[model samples]
Each structure stands twice: as structure tokens, then as C-alpha cells.
Target: MDKNIVFLLNFKINKASSSRKRGSRLIQNLDSRLRGNDKRVKVKKRKKFVLLSLVFNYILFVIYRLSYAAKYLIN
Candidate 1:
């Protein structure tokens, strides 16, 4: 009877350890996915910032040209 009890305890310990390993794997997968998503979002935001700066520079160029033309006409 004592041997049977020992065997049962060992089996339970093995099962519990396996389940813990599976849980750890699941958490790692979730963490990796979140990191990937964060990188994508950062890339998109940088692209948007670059596009906005380009547009602003174009507008400034146009304004400069218009002022220069007006000065020439006045002279």
C-alpha cells in the first residue's frame, strides 16, 4: 500500500510540472505577439510623422515663391 501511494504521488507531481511548462509557453507566446504589435505601431507612427513634415515643407516652399513673385511685381 505504501508503494502504491508513492507511485501515485510521483504521477501527480509529473502532471503538475508538465502543466506548468505549458502555461509558461503560452505566456511567452503572448509576450512575443505584443512586442511585435508594438513595433508595428511605432513604425506606422514614424511614417506618419515623416509624411506630415514633407507636406509642411512643401507649403512653406509655395509661400516663399508667392512672396517672391509679389515683390517682383511691386518693383
Candidate 2:
């Protein structure tokens, strides 16, 4: 009877350990996926900022060219 009890206890311990390992692996996978998504969001924001800056610069250049043209015409 004592031997049977020991075997059952050992089996329970192994089962618990295996479950813990699986849970940790699941957490690690979720963390990596979240990090990947965050990086993509950051990249998208950076691209949007660059595009807006280019548009603003182009508008400023056009305005400067228009002012120069008006000045030449007045002369």
C-alpha cells in the first residue's frame, strides 16, 4: 500500500510540472507576439510622420517659388 501511494504522488508531481512548463511556454509566445505588433505600430507611425513632413516641405517650397515669380514679374 505504501509503495502504491508513493507512485501516485510521484505521478501527480510530474503532471503538475508538465502543466507548469506548458503555461510558461504559452506566456512566452504571447509576449513575443505582442512585441511584434508593437514594433509594427511604431513603424507605421514613423512612416506617417515622414510623409507629413515631406508634404509640408513641398508646400513651403511652392510658396517660395511663387513669391519669387511675383517679384520677377513686378520688376
Candidate 3:
């Protein structure tokens, strides 16, 4: 392990915790940017879920149409 890196990280962690009130969150006190990123990540996940549902529904519809066409042809 690099001594310099460990020292720098420790210094930062100590500095952040020292500045905040007792019993408050330590890491989150550093910045609100992380909170915003969490929201963006959640929204992206929601969009991906919506897209997957749409594709699944479309596939089911296609199968249904094919089955209906085959039944009519048989008759």
C-alpha cells in the first residue's frame, strides 16, 4: 500500500467528519451532488424497466397475431 495515498485519504475523512455536527452523516456532508446522482440513477432504471415491458408486450402481441392468423387459415 502507498503511504501517501493512505495519509491523504485519512486526512480527508477526518477533515470532513470534524466539520459536521455530532451524530450527523459523515460522507454525505461533503456534497449534495451525490444525492442528485442517486435520483438520476433511479430515473434511468425506471426508463429501462418501461422499455423492457414494452418489448415484452410487443412480443406477446406478435405471437397472438400469428396464432390468430394460423387458426383462420386452418378454417
- TM-score, every prediction: 0.54, 0.54, 0.53
Any runs in candidate 3 off by more than 4 Å, and if so which?
1-37
Clashing pairs in 1: none
TM-score of 2: 0.54
RMSD of each: 13.6, 13.6, 6.7
| lDDT per model vs. reference | 0.73, 0.73, 0.69
Clashes of 3: 0
lDDT of 1 by residue, 10-66 (tens): 565565566887656555554555456655677899999999999999999999999
Model 3 Cα lDDT, one tens digit per residue, 3-62:
875575566678767556632444443233334556557889999999999999999999
TM-score of predicted model 1? Answer: 0.54
lDDT of 1 at 71: 100
Q: Candidate 2: deviation at residue 10, Å? A: 27
Best-to-worst ranking by TM-score: 1, 2, 3
